[model samples]
Target: MSDMTMTAAVEAALPKAPFEGRHLIDGIWRGSDNGESFDRTSPSHGILVSRSARAGRAETEAAIGAARKAFDDGRWSRISGKERATLLLKVADLIEANVERMALLETLESGKPISQARGEISGAADLWRYAASLARTMHGDSHNSLGEDMLAMVLKEPIGVVSIITPWNFPFWILSQKLPFALAAGCTCVIKPSEMTPSTTVILGELLLQAGLPVGVVNIVLGFGQPVGALMAEHPDVDMVSFTGSTAVGKAIAAAASVTLKKVALELGGKNPQVVFPDADLESAADAITFGVYFNAGECCNSGSRIIVHEDIADTLVEKVVALSKKVAFGDPLNPETQVGAIISQAHQEKIAGYVKDALAAGARVKLGGAPVSHPGLPGRFFAPTVVTGVTADMAIAREEVFGPVLSVLTFRTLEEAIALTNDAAYGLSAGVWSENVHTCLAFARRAEAGTVWTNTWMDGFPEVAFGGYKQSGQGRENGHYGLEEFLEIKSVVMRVGRTRSNWVRA
Candidate 1:
């Protein structure tokens, strides 16, 4: 179906003005106490999409206070696992029902292609369903080996008041990754979504309430990262802080939360590498590498921006990559045919372009598309799908996380050199190795320092697997049972059946 038909059908299915510019606290929509708000504009066309309330310190405190109350009062945290599971299932159903509207809002606010947005929305519903299943299976432990004299058991208790701060890119998808697990763990939360893309997340607040989540079970406070995010990180009442952003910001949040010693789960930046071996299928490797670096405009934390290839296959691989990248469509995000949409903002576009410009000045050869693409009358932030050859490990473009649609190609003479080059970077979130030989690929996968390693694949996985980083990439896992564990605290219980001990102090 056409893009217009899809959008028209979605509009017809939902009510107008679903997203309101207000904070969702205590199960109600309200304005910021400071009377501050901000306008969210479409990065695709620089048009205002919605005016969301910019919550400050007071609002942040209020949200935190409400979450704490809900948890301590047993309004949410003390609920049965089956009950929480039921609520989460309802949330998943609601999300599936409203996929069109959520996808449209995400595209309008974040400037991603409508098709990609729709996929992310559907994926979010899947995540919610998966987490709901986990909620029912959140089991503790019991040991009968203690015999009749004593009994021992381990209980998993909820870590109260989680503060979630999600990024602008993939706003709803990332939020779904963290929030559902937190809720499944029976933790009440206060969410601080990115100011650049707050509309869809705010709309989710309504869905949560409609799903029958109790008041203050999940609150969303929208604002800049400074006062809102910083305050949430440092708040003493908050038991844990879960953040998905840059390593620098993660460090700051970790340091600030250290004051209260709150549990922190960080999913940070990455300089992922995709290694193509001489024996690999060149065409498939090229296609996978193109998708690795160009998907979501390369705004992904695990984006394989570093392309390390065998010297023998370098020429043929680069040729195929250049050809495929040229065909990547860049245009209005609402258009279904546009594979590559606008950058998150103008400033980000400049940052991405600056990396390419620096590489060119450093004597790097541009295999194809080293400049930004301007679409007349669109006024959206768009960069060309870039592929640079002759990139040295010492260059900033190869070392730093550019977070753009730019791929740096570096050739390796041997398997040892390929592994060394991939591990040389400070960040190790993910890596991809392509080879027909099973032993060679398995060895490469075992040696790669990244948390996730894909053989003959770039970025492919199910939500059941654990995903996170090693070195500077991140601190904790984000999917499966590991994600649920991030928000749980272990407690041990013991009971003596046969003996009553006399106190030594009495003697």
Candidate 2:
């Protein structure tokens, strides 16, 4: 499509006005004390999309104080499981009801396809619902058989106030992953959404309020990491910090939170790989590989950005993947038919192009697109779907995350070689193996170092399954019951029955 035609279509779909957002502290919506604010322009449309309050140290500390008071006062932390579950379910209902509103804003701010953004928002509702179920089922253990005179009990309790920092790629969904689960576990929280995509999270705060969440139980401060996020991580009142972003930032948050010995949960970067075998379904594998790389334009932490294929079928697999990549639509995110959307920002676009350029300079071959694309009407930045061949384990493109719709192809001669190449990177977020043979799939699944392994598939996620990473990818899991446990602490109690305990001191 011509750039002008695309631009016209996108412009027609743009919202009449940008969203206005503010911090939610102690159940009240308010602007930054200094009246500071920041605006976000749609990366695809090149128009203003949101203006959010820019929080500073004072706002950050206020949010922390509110959460701390809420937790200590038992406003939410001591609530009944049934009560917490009821409120969470209401929030889930609200999320579903507002899917269209949230999704449109998300697509505008994050530059993901509208369909994908809708799916993310809808999927987030399920996370909230799953967390509600967890609230009801959460339990502790009783040691009735320990002894007649000495009985014991193991209890699970909320870990107190939590600092939740979410990323822009999946702002609403990632926040849902942490917030609802923390609430379900009886932990009050202070959230800091990525400044680039802060609207959807603010809208979520509205839903939370409508759900009748207790005052001070959930607070949000919108701003950059320096004053807002850094304070959240370092606050002594925060019992734990849950962050999802780059590995470097995760490390910094961990270090800052370490001074107080607070618990830290990080979901960081990934250079996830999908291994293709000679006996695998080439067509399915190729399609999945294309989808995996292009989904969210490859901004996902679990993105199958790299692939290790059996040397014998490497050429055939690459050919099939390139063909599929060409078929996937790429354009403005507002267009529902568009499969891959704009780059998140100009800087990120440059980063992606630089990776492909460096790979070519380092002797790698571009099987498909290797440059930026321009559409007539859209003012946003876009990159062509890229496929780089001749990628070796040692190349930066092979190990580092390009975070664009780019794929790196590496060849392996044997199962051992494929596994070695898959685990060669510092990240162990996710891995996939495509083979019809059950034994081969089992072997790969058992050996892959990633937190989640897919056989005959890629990126199939569920609220029932736990998601996270290993090694540098991250620490701690999100989703399912394990997600709820991340916000909880264990306590053991021992008691003497009927005053049967004896004193050791000679009194």
Candidate 3:
């Protein structure tokens, strides 16, 4: 009676692998100190997929020690940027060669559509290429003028050993975002991917090895947030730490890194807003807005979950949005027709669902969907795309990052109010404004609290444009020269011909 395609079943029923995650120390893969491991399941089908290392403090120490040795030994950082770029490009080629496999793994782990995963995988490959291209361009500074006989210059160098912790939503995307830039700046790394999704990172390690990178230059350690992640954060050997996850975790990592004065770059969570003006194209806005939040099942950092619409057009836009939301077919991630896929897991589904229920309790209206779908004989944790109308600034759905297919709608009387409403949250990753007025667009773009403000778009990313957040959204930008700068530190060397110390005051 079901019309499910064979591709769907093949994807949903792929045989799982083993507990294969290992600590990549000294250019080799080794198990955790105690061989401890944990299993991760496919959220789309509720089946076991792989077991990763449950790394503890001991394994963590080995990774840190290895990184220290690599930095001290001058194997990677001492190398030229062109050589590093070559190796990085080699890695990119390997990734491009095996993108399909990586895409499938990502889809299995995150329950995102296979097509979307394919695009993400492809995008990651491009990211590596982009990093490679920028590698040769990372330059320091040259200055002279101390007493006319002195010459001074500055050198931008690696921040020493780095620890990059990525998230489940985008294992490869975030890892590539951090790794290439660090390597381009001549720093080695110890990567700890999300325990929920480690397969792609594991394979990435393999590709790096094939790319002929120096031993101990890059290490992959699998672990959760407690001992392994905590140890890596506070580890003295790790001079810098980069994380892409929740704001809560970013704060903790930042605090831990503070003890050692380590450089930390965080791409944390967001509760971004999308504003729609009365004079704007409601249809285009509706389409963009719908896809903006509902894409990736609304699990993006800049989901535009909060929509501030002009009160005059609020009613029409709501209906357009509702109708548009209903047409996004959801069933199988493999099918290109499926616009929405499964939630990450039952717990996550319930978490997003809980927000919807709480919104209803707070007198919000469910304009489209607010519950999970029922598929007989299939135990997938799938939540229908949900839209919450009549949302207030104080509501939980508006304040917190639901991180699901849930959108909270609000009304604004004018552009100033809209800007105020959008900036009311602690996040400032990205925002969108739909208006034809150039002044209005410029005003909102300048005033929006977020770092990236789109005049008439959402979720659009490029390798050249700079992106990051302010306030609680996170620290430091990713993409472009700004992104490369995040992985580097500037050190000035002052030269003086007349070396005697001279002061206005005599001792």
- The top-ranked prediction according to lDDT is 2
- Look at candidate 3 and tell me the lDDT of residue 495: 80
Tens-digit lDDT track for model 2 on 385-436?
A: 8899999888999999889988999999989998899888899999999999
- Model 1, stretches more than 4 Å misplaced? 1-19, 500-507
Estimated TM-score per prediction? 0.95, 0.98, 0.95
338 Cα displacement, candidate 3 (Å): 2.2
Model 1 residue 217 CA deviation in Å? 0.8
Would you list the rank order by lDDT, best first? 2, 1, 3
What lDDT score belongs to each candidate, Candidate 1 first?
0.87, 0.91, 0.84
Which residue pairs in candidate 2 have backbone atoms (N, alpha carbon, C) closer than 3 angstroms, thus clashing?
3-375, 3-376, 3-377, 4-376, 4-377, 7-377
Clashes of each: 0, 6, 0
Q: lDDT (0-100) at residue 502 of candidate 3?
A: 73
Greater-TM-score candidate between 1 and 2:
2
lDDT of 3: 0.84
Clashing pairs in 3: none
- Model 3: per-residue Cα lDDT over 468-497, one tens digit each: 999999989888999899888889988876
Across 1-507, the per-residue lDDT of candidate 1 in tens digits comes to: 111111111222222443566899888899988687888777876667778888888888989999999999988788888999899889988988898888888887888989999998888888888888898899899888986677888999999999999999989989999999999999999998888889888888999988888998899898998899999999999999999999999999999999999999999999999998888988889899989898999998988898999888888898898878777776778777777788898888889989989998998988777767666647677777788999999999999999999999999998899999999988989999999999989999999999999999878867798889999998999888998999999999988876665577974
Model 3: runs farther than 4 Å from truth? 1-13, 16-19, 145-147, 497-507
